[model samples]
Target chain A: MNKVWWKILGSVLVIYTAIAGLLLGVPRLPILNESIRNLYFHVPMWFAMIVLFSISVFYSVKSLSSKSEIDDIKAVESVNAGIIFGLLGLVTGAIWAKYTWGQFWSFDPKQNFAAISVLLYFAYLILRNAIDEEQKRAKISAIYNIFAFPMMVVLLFVLPRLKDSLHPGNGGNPGFNSYDLDSRMRMVFYPACLGWILIGYWVYTIRFRIRSIEVKQQAN
Target chain B: MKKILFSLLLTLATVQLFAQDNGVEMADKLRSDGKIYVVVLCIVIILFGLLAYLFSIDKRLKKIEKENFPKN
Candidate 1:
């Protein structure tokens, strides 16, 4: 009863956004046209991914300090959840780009940097698998997780801004707030981001619970 | 002075009706004929269906937990 409300809210907000996003009016801009509705669905995936990745890093730091296996389980599960959202963001962004930017993979700084950051996390996962022992795996991966997180921050946030790119808020491009997004869109957009982030957290918790059960079974 | 400010704000608000950008073509035909709801229906169904699938998995995990672990 206590934890269920937000999960229910996430589902409700997502459904509301899907309906309102399609039916509600949007700002008319060149190239985006009707596809501006992608703002509701596509943008939320990255917001959710970023939120989950931040959670993963926080738990990694906790596991390093506390030496708790549960913290390590949380860190790994959050990463797994984050990766799913990241891939969704990448594919949806590519599809949106193809319609608007002429090519699916046009070497846009945002796209390239995004792919690299995802690969960096994947490397973290592989690094964990290579170690057979639990304590060594947790500590070493926590170090790597902490180390890689700052570089990923640079890759996703700063590097893209330094180069010419088609992504909003990059190079000379205007952001949604500057043009496409208006007060009406904000009504849906903010809730959509909140909904997706909450859903990502929900998925992470479920995965954490399942992993904990497995660990307990193994112990017994 | 209060009346002047109120009138000015009202005028500013109404000016948006005459903004310069040309309006894009909305799917007026589909919306008018009510087919746009079909698209909305499909999207809602897909979103809810995925959520339902997740809930089922959660139930299965709960069952496993009950079977194997010490109940609190």
Candidate 2:
């Protein structure tokens, strides 16, 4: 979509998210209470983070196979956005956990996994900076990016299920699967997720354009 | 697609278990008095507006470039 339309669509989605989140994100029902409402933001942030990181990995692969500068740019932008969302997800989740679990930072599988993912990307950025050759940097970064996805998948998805913890969905801990979400909450929750994902994409696009412009300016 | 379905299933189970718990009702009642939701709403609205504005400005720049430097 063009810029104006993107703004318009994004505005509408944000408005929708706000209204829906306020009405439903704060738990009012008999089962979930208020802490449950954090799902509107926490879960979706992580979802967007994963989606963006996955996109980065895809672009990294493309850049490797074709030696395309465009693919390299895309990989960089996606990873940058992914990191932002990942940090936000981590902070929001910590807050949610504090309220629900009475602790700020637990050594839970999910928490540790997320921290590792963030550190991995931090290394990715460093790798890019340490290299002077454009093609070499792109290739190496792509190789590193590929490794990131499996690490994330294992940390976020696999490890949590393998062991028991107080965190949701672990060790018989309550999670989205074990709990009964009301239909009313679902109405807003789905849209909230879509809105967040779209906004994430929107942010990525803007950053990508800016990066492209900077590259052009440098070349000229 | 399958993952989405699975996530949904997992979500359903979590919600079911939550609904069965007895203390949630009391917590909900107390939460309603806090009005934190309103703050969240306002923050989201502001963020949306800022991003939209930034995107529009970027679009305008591109349009200007296209107008000034047309390829023959």
Candidate 3:
């Protein structure tokens, strides 16, 4: 509630990015052409997803140490928000790839790893649901969350870089790094990441509040 | 030289895409006519509408919590 201004800023930034991203002139690279504009919509989803998942892992660590119910609630909500963003990123990436690469699923290293990492999170949700007792569920899932976060990082960030990837910056493929370093694209891209990440957090906060309310209701 | 050639091909590709799709326009006309505002407007409307729904849910949840949970 007190952080309402940031939420407003986030929404404003997203809208601004959307409009500007459409109208702004890009480098006119081959294969990308106008679709380079997807940088605003698609790339931000992954940034937001990673931010949310990191928040989830942080809270999982908190719950493990402090053993607080609120911490677990925060963890679960962050993961829920994270999964939503990850799925959005995947779908958008697929659409962009289809228009450019001539296929929906190219089995690109980045894409394959991304799919596996998302499945890892889905497995986290399944693990959570498999447990019945509240504290037991929280502790076990928190552990699974902590366990899963590192593998996801390796899957998404580290491994992709190590191998030949269709994505930029990997396998010697020219990626955003080529244009991202010195271009007007940076002007919109960074803000887009911040905006989408804030929006994800806003959603996470609301989900946490709702779950907290449910917890109180159950108590009564 | 390579960049120029690639750009030329890409431009043709975009043009070909526009030329091929008639019944299902790719908004090429809208973009060329500088009427992308229409697309922007529609997208902004959808984004704001979703945010508005979230805002309403937040308000309702707060009210329910206030009514159901005693203040300590």
lDDT of 3 at A50: 94
Off by over 4 Å in 1: B1-34
Query: What would the per-residue lDDT of candidate 3 be over residues A29-116, giving only the tens digit for each residue?
Result: 7887788889889999999999999999999999989999999999989999999999999999999989888888899888999999
TM-scores of the candidates in the order shown? 0.87, 0.79, 0.85
Count clashes in each candidate, considering only residues at least 3 apart in sequence or on different chains: 0, 18, 1
- lDDT of each prediction vs. the true structure? 0.89, 0.77, 0.86
lDDT per residue, candidate 1, A76-155, as tens digits?
Answer: 89999999999999999999999999998998999999999999999999999999999999999999999888988899
Candidate 3 runs further than 4 Å off:
B1-34, B69-72
Report the lDDT tens digits of candidate 1 across residue range B1-72.
999999999998767656523545565555663587879889999999998887788788778878876573
> Candidate 3's residue-wise lDDT over B1-72, tens digit each?
999999999998789566765546565556674688788878889889887786677678678767876582
Scored by DockQ, the top model is: 1
| Worst ten in a row by lDDT for model 1 chain B | B19-28
| Clashing pairs in model 1, backbone N/Cα/C closer than 3 A | none
What shift in Å separates residue A154 of candidate 1 from its native position after superposition? 1.2
**Which candidate tops lDDT?**
1
Which runs of model 2 end up more than 4 angstroms from their true locations? Answer: A1-7, A25-32, B1-41, B60-72
